[model samples]
Target: MSNNLFKDLVSSVEQAGVEVNHEALQVAKDKLAMKSIIIRVISILGSLLGLGLFIGFIALAASDIFQEAIAFILMGVLFLGGAFALNRSNDGAITVSIAVSLYIIGYAFLSYGLSNDGHLMGYSMFVIALITLFLYNNHIISFLSSLSILVAIHFIMFDLDIQTFYYIYLAIVLAATTYLFWQEQRLRTMDNLIGHRYLPIFAALFTYTLVTGIISSTQQFGYYYFSEFRGVRLFFITVLVAALLFTVHLVLDKMKVSKLPIQIATYLLVIIFNVLVAYYYPAFGIACLFILWGFMRQFKAGFAVGIATLVWAMGMFYYDLGVSLLAKSISLMIVGAMFLAIYYLIQKKGEKHDNI
Candidate 1:
């Protein structure tokens, strides 16, 4: 009997040892994964910084004695060669760096070759964007290409006084956004695709472009020479179109959830709010969108951006207000209370849903 008891004790000790070993192994693996993620993030930042430095160097060189067409052409060739070499070696960071360098150098050459003619330079930029978009494997390249194309279009529209150009530009942006929404779905479906991992970065860039475009449109800038009535009409029309696009994006995002009706209602309410805010206080509207996006995506970086925008909007709005200090303080208090109440109600609803 004693011998059997001694054997049982030995077995229990061995089991405990095994459990401890398993837990330790899992902890080690978690730490290693965290470290790896940190390293990758650092590497991405380093790559971006390296590309910036390279572009700065090129700019300095071009601004100095290397202002001639031949010099720009040679710079483009040098970057093209580096891109080819990096592509052959399959180095993602260096390849992306070289591609960005090539983009700027190519643009410089285009501007020089076209003698700074706006029309030709604009078209050349589009051609450059298309070429880079098609040839590059990195999503960063796609982002840069899209950005270049957008900038080129904006540059072309700089002196335009036509309502049609504004409409066309907004339409093109909506179409591009729709394409990206679908592309995001495709990326999720093919999770193993090389660009799938970069979807968040792409989404962030797309969001930035959309937000900026909407804000620019709100300003009634050089897009059109409109009378007061026409300006108001065009502004509301643009806001309405943009709100509809945002609704479409939200639908795409929440399509998998079962609460379709509730989601639809919520999205509609949000759209209505956005339109109202944008019509009155455009900066605040942009801030609201950023904050909503951050909350929906659970993205901390987005939250940071949204908070910054919110502060800016608030500062701008209150800066020139004629309200007395007491009134302003009371208004702020009321607003804070409303926010708290809303938060509490939402939390309660979430809890009820979870319980159900």
Candidate 2:
């Protein structure tokens, strides 16, 4: 087995009391490494090209069926069934690539077929996503299906105009995602399939939750025009803020921050940032949420995402600010100064931990 995989196996065995079959792991890794990484990547890319061509041919051949919703539904079911069957023996990256294309195309067909019936489409998506989670164990499929479920709920609630319930749903998602990430070890080592699929699901949850925060912050800043449910959107954003604070609590605990005064001060700065972001800096609160979670988890990719989000949020703040250039500069300077001060404090705390 490769070094990282070997280490992961060791951690799983030690921390979670999971059994590791060393001989089987080595055989599996050797099989996977039979081809060079570049060849596997090229094969997947070539498969994508083939799938695209196939889709194009199907589109042209079935042009007449596009007008009939029933035809679309039938074709969608057929495609989904094909993908599921293909994935039953899905081994290579090339096979997975093709199956994934078919799966997405299946959903696209269903979406178009049920375009006019928003409620029906939402329900179908939810059911299908749940079914796909069980029937298709691929990481990409799980991630996409999880996102579909979220989008389906939002669509259903939006269609019904249940503003309050929609926000409640978002809160529930936030809570669930928080719990999932907190219990990552258990989930990732529960069993074979669960272990294989945990990361993608967590990734989907984190991504959707963070992106929602970004959009909500933008809407609050008058970037997106909401016809109604403005207050409810604010409530949703508040839930994100609460999630951020919860992540901050986790990070402080991780850093062994025991001083009550320091904790209180850190939270105070977060609140101040929240207030400022509510008024001027779009997505800043969400960016900080990313940063805190990245710190808590020591996830470098999430950290990179947080940095990118912070930069984008600042750009949006400047571009969307209607005030004079001088005013914009002043506002940005204040945000920058506060951001740096908080970062410095966090850095110092981290250094203190390392010294200990």
Candidate 3:
């Protein structure tokens, strides 16, 4: 009788375990179904939001102010609503998309006001829009916000002096760029993927500066008819600078040079270039020679040689020496030889240090 009771107890325990397993499986299935439903709902909402924005754009283009305003308001509401919903749902993409949509709507409203001769209202709208955009950690939105602010300042605040406006823009851009660079550096140190992604952005910015500088110089000094054509020259210069900088960075990486040295060389070169461009004096060439000497002392042979070549070329082009063209060519050759000798000496020292 006791043996019969033990068998019955074991059977009961096994049955209970099977029941528990079945319940757990059902719970998992329910959770998965809930997730699927949420995903579908978010997708539908996104589609609707996109459709609404498209209709709003059409209304705007038709110059139906009432319709446009209504559409924009609707768009903003939809995005804000979606963002709120997604935050609760723990859907990152939904949250980000909605936030971006809100920013776009704000920008559109600001633009409309500005174009319609409502400068005060436009400026107010833009300021509000920038604040909203800044709350979101999206780079695209941030850049657009900055650009909108710049445009508003340029067009609406016409009373400000051009130089003042230029300086303000420069300061803003520089601050933003420095922040981004610092972020990139931090991410790189942490081995994050985002660290490398900003390279193209930096390249693009440098290109823009180069292109704009060229166009403005050409238009002001080269007697261009319209300011519109200025951008083309600026664009080419931007391309050239981007290409050169990219190459330099690439080579430095391959050579396993420390980033500090590369950065220092870049800074020195930039300062020398700026001084030369600003002064347009023969003495700048002498200053460049001294800068090159400093770089050589720091074991930046490649950079020193590159700067020396640049100075020599610029001098030859700008200075109309009483001497013949042959004399200029001979002088440049001598300068080139000097650079080669210096580079060789530095290379030998570096080699010896490595050997030891």
lDDT of each structure?
0.53, 0.70, 0.45
Predicted structure with the largest TM-score when compared to the true one: 2
| Global fold similarity of model 2 (TM-score) | 0.75
What's the true lDDT of residue 128 in model 2?
Answer: 81
lDDT of 1: 0.53
Clashing pairs in 1: none
- Return the TM-score for each candidate structure: 0.59, 0.75, 0.40
Error of 1 at 299 (Å): 2.8
Error of 3 at 271 (Å): 4.6
User: Which stretches of candidate 3 lie above 4 Å from their native place?
Assistant: 1-53, 56-102, 110-118, 154-165, 179-272, 278-356
Measured on C-alpha atoms, candidate 2 has an lDDT of 0.70
Residue pairs of candidate 2 with colliding backbone atoms: none
Candidate 1 or 3, higher TM-score? 1
Q: How does candidate 3 fare on TM-score? A: 0.40
